[model samples]
Each structure stands twice: as structure tokens, then as C-alpha cells.
Target: MLGQDPDAAQELMHSWAAQLSTRAQAAAELSDRVATIASSAVGANGAVRVTVGASGALTDLRLDDRVQRIPGAELAITIMAAIARAQAGLTEQVSIAVHDTVGTDSETGRAITDTFARRFPKPADEQPDRSERDARDGW
Candidate 1:
């Protein structure tokens, strides 16, 4: 068949190469987007704000003047809670990035999402319950 219809096989190979290139581009785009992702959370009636990067590392923490009213130990707890809450959001943010870039149904998408979910799972207690969010929102 090589001599009978060589063009057919060449065309098929071209199509496969093109598909592979497209997928590689999509995966690179997804990686770029995920790398730039940052998630944040507020706690303690807006006294504390925490931001975490794609790796679930604390990139920023903000404490309002109201933090002065909170006891030292309590403020520590609030900040820690906010950090966990922020980390928990990393999975959601990555999922959105993955969906937008590669689609969640893809193997790459599922792997990336599952890794993030496992690394930054919602804190054991899912810190910052309804009351904490309400306070942060001034409710």
C-alpha cells in the first residue's frame, strides 16, 4: 500500500502532528495561566487578608488597623485561618484556568486539577465558617 497510496499515510501523519502541536500549545498556555494564579481570603471582620500563589505559598498578608484590637494569639489564629482558606481556593482557581485553557475533560486538565485539589485541599475543618465570612463581610 506504500506505493499504492502513499499520500494517504502522509496526510494522516500530518494530521496527527498538527493535533499534537495544538495540544502542546494548549498545555503550555494552561501552565502559564496556572503559574500566575493567586487566590485570596479575608478573615476576622476584615482585619486579616491572605493571598496564596499556585503552589499554595503565602504571597501576601494584609492586616487592617482593626487588627490592633485583636489579641496577639487570636490574630495569629485569624491569619492562619485566612491562609488556609486562601489555599483552599487554589484548586478552584486552577480548575477554571484548566477549563479555559485545556478543558476540564482532558487528561491534562484532570491531572492538573487533581494535583491541586490534593495539595491544597479545603483545610481539615474548612476554616473560616459562616460566622467568619459574615464578619468579614460586615454582616
Candidate 2:
């Protein structure tokens, strides 16, 4: 008959429990930091305002009465731009949280930042090509 070592088994159980506790603490801290994330932006002379949550989801939007003076298309563009800016700000906050928790060089940190970068790309100044328009118009 083989006999089991009680002391060794007890030590192993304690080690596992400690590891689990440490992981739980880290997860809790990350959750708290993420919950604190909120970003906002104002657009077009404060005619439009936008706020985004930690995951870049829009949480709130406000339009000033002056927005009525702008054309519909222009107002739409301004609102969209504001939302994009707010999303970008949220991504920045998430990047900081990831860096603080997992280190920027770690695989987890890299994946998080990469995801945000791909999802919320930097805004660019885009205009229709004048040459194409002229050709189409036969000017």
C-alpha cells in the first residue's frame, strides 16, 4: 500500500489558493480603472457635444440651440466628428489602463492597444478630388 504525504498536499493547496487570490485582486483593480473611464469632446464652436464610455460606446450627446443655424449636412458632419474625437479619447484611456496593469511591452497590452488603434483610427481631413469632379462635369 502507498501512503500519501499530507504535508506536501497541504502546501500545494495553499500555493494554489494564493495564486488565485492574486489573480482576483488584479482583475478587480482593472475593472475599477475601466469603470472610471469617460471621455468627451465639443465640436464646431461647441454646437455639438459627445461623451463615450470605456469601450468607445457613445454614452451621451448634446446639441446647442445654435446648431439649428447650421445646415443639416454640416450639423451632421460636426456631430460625427465630435463622436469620433470622444471615442479616440476613450481609447487613449484604455491604453493607459492596459499599460498600467500589464505593461506596454507585454502581449496582453500590445493586443489591447492594437485593437483600439484599429477600431478607432485617427481622423483625417478628407475632401473630394477636384480633378475627378472637373472631369465628370466636363469643365
Candidate 3:
């Protein structure tokens, strides 16, 4: 009502429509980039390899012939580690893509990156021993 001259109202509506169109285009492009996201990693000594998709779902896995040299449990651990690394790589790619598309400071970008970061936290250097901590703290 404050700025409701007919021509001014028409111009304001046009500006709002243009802004919405731009956002729609940007979202579409981001979707396209995410749809193609993938990352791969190989385990130490090349015994295992893995690839993960945008959602951190495993798309491929490979085991070198040398994997037979390791015990079954060790080999399984190696494979799981490789898959985790691959998923981490995929999360990094998604973060970059979201930053590029929506700007890291924007609400959409922060939401996207924060979700991935929470879901795929960086591996810790060493896990704390709960028993040791409890003993030291007199728990």
C-alpha cells in the first residue's frame, strides 16, 4: 500500500519474478553437479580400492590379488577403511560444488556443507580410550 502506484507495483513484481527465476536456475545447476559427483580412494599398500557417489553410497570396490596375503579380518578392515576414505572424498567434492554454486556463506550453501560435514566427520588421529579417561578422572 505504501508504494502501490500501478506502474511501481508492476515493476516490483517483475523484479521479484526475476529473482525467483535466477534462484531456480542456480538450484537446477547445483542439482546437475551433485548428480554426477563421485570420488575414489585406494587403501594403503593398494590392497583395496573404493568409489562412492554423491550420497556417499558405494559405487565400486576392488581388492588387489595381494589382499589374499592378509588374514580375512585384516582384509575386511582394509576394505572398510578404503570405503570410508572414498566417501570422505565424495563429501569434499560435494562441499566444493555447493560452495561454487551457492557461495559458502549463503544459507543454502551452509546447510548443504554442514550436513555433509556432520555426516562425514574427518577421521580422528587416535581414538581416546574410555577406560583410561575414566581411570584418570576417577569416574
Q: How accurate locally, in lDDT, is each candidate?
A: 0.86, 0.74, 0.74
Off by over 4 Å in 2: 1-24, 126-139
Model 1 lDDT tens row, 1-139: 7567989989988999999999999999999998998999998766789999988899998988888877787778888888888988999999998889889999999999999999888878745644466578997
Error of 2 at 17 (Å): 8.2
Every model: Cα RMSD to truth: 3.6, 7.0, 7.4
Candidate 3 C-alpha error for residue 75, in Å = 1.3
Candidate achieving higher TM-score, 1 or 2: 1
Please list all clashing residue pairs in model 3, or write none if there are none. none
Query: Model 2, 80: alpha-carbon shift in Å?
Result: 0.5
Sort every candidate by TM-score, greatest first.
1, 3, 2
Q: How many backbone clashes does every candidate have?
A: 0, 0, 0
Question: Highest TM-score among the candidates is held by which one?
Answer: 1
Task: For residues 41-112, write the lDDT of model 2, one tens digit per residue.
Answer: 887666678898877788899987877776787677777877777877777887888777756776666777
Candidate 3 deviation (Cα RMSD) = 7.4
Encode model 3's per-residue lDDT on 1-139: one tens digit a residue: 7385988899899999998898778778778998899988776456577888888889988877776666677666666766777777766887888877877887877888888778866655522233334467996
Model 3, which residues run further than 4 Å from truth? 1-4, 126-139
